[model samples]
Target: MILTLIAYALLAGLALIVYLSWSFSPRLTVGVAGLLSLFLAHGAWKIFRKPTKGRGYRALAAATTAGFTLTAATAVFVLFYGAGCGCM
Candidate 1:
């Protein structure tokens, strides 16, 4: 469980670094973001499944902290930062 969380954190870090090179490497940025999201989802699932309950809660707390940065950084790109970025 802890290993999964650590892997997620590492991917999150890579995504942040990739975000800095956005204009020059948009595809890489997207790739890293996708990886981070995958790991987070996997970790969350593992944490949820464990028999020990608080471990999941604690992991969720940590994930939320890590996820805040991801959302803040990528919201502009993925969440329709503008009013009409083709969304309905």
Candidate 2:
């Protein structure tokens, strides 16, 4: 389904961002994670903006939003919790 593809694409995009960031600066991994988290949240928002007439699509959208929310929260925690401590 289209929604599934969109969700996968978002996941792939986040993974690519993480990979690129890690390759470029291992020291800034937390910052990159936070950025990717924001991106995921944005993707989730976009997904929610689409109108879904079926229960399945609604459920999928909810799951995607929840996953993105968790990622964003974890990223923020990692960013602030690892600041200046070099605990990446």
Candidate 3:
């Protein structure tokens, strides 16, 4: 319960930060977001692979999976459009 709330709050914070930096280079945006996501992904992986009867574990796992999927799709978008947007 508390964990889910915190994760969501952090997720929203991340989204806001990314939105605020919209003018940043796309590759930089992707890199920073990807770097940040590494921790989230790791946590999610642990939660999914080893369930310790934690509260809201299922919700957290779902959120993490969705986050990863969206991130991956964004990467694909960047790969396709990044060069046009001045990414080196």
Model 2: per-residue Cα lDDT over 1-88, one tens digit each: 5544555555557789878878889879987668766767765885667664654545645666777878767656545543434433
> Tens digit of lDDT per residue, candidate 3, span 1-88?
5544554555557678877777767788888878767857865575467556656646656776777667666556545544343424
Residue 28, model 2: lDDT of 96
Positional deviation of residue 36's Cα in model 3 after best superposition, in angstroms: 3.5
At residue 56, give the lDDT of candidate 2: 52
Per-candidate count of clashing residue pairs (backbone under 3 Å): 0, 0, 0
List where candidate 3 sits over 4 angstroms from the true fold: 1-35, 43-57, 85-87
Error of 3 at 81 (Å): 1.6
Measured over all alpha carbons after superposition, the RMSD of each candidate to the real structure, in angstroms, is 12.4, 12.9, 12.4
Arrange candidates, best lDDT first. 2, 3, 1
Q: Write the per-residue lDDT of candidate 1 for residues 1-88, one digit (tens) a residue.
A: 5544554555568667766779778888788878877766755554466466454356655675467556555554433333232433
TM for every model, in the order presented, reads 0.36, 0.39, 0.40
- Model 1, stretches more than 4 Å misplaced? 1-19, 50-88
Which predicted model would earn the best lDDT?
2
lDDT of 1 at 3: 46
Candidate 2 colliding pairs: none
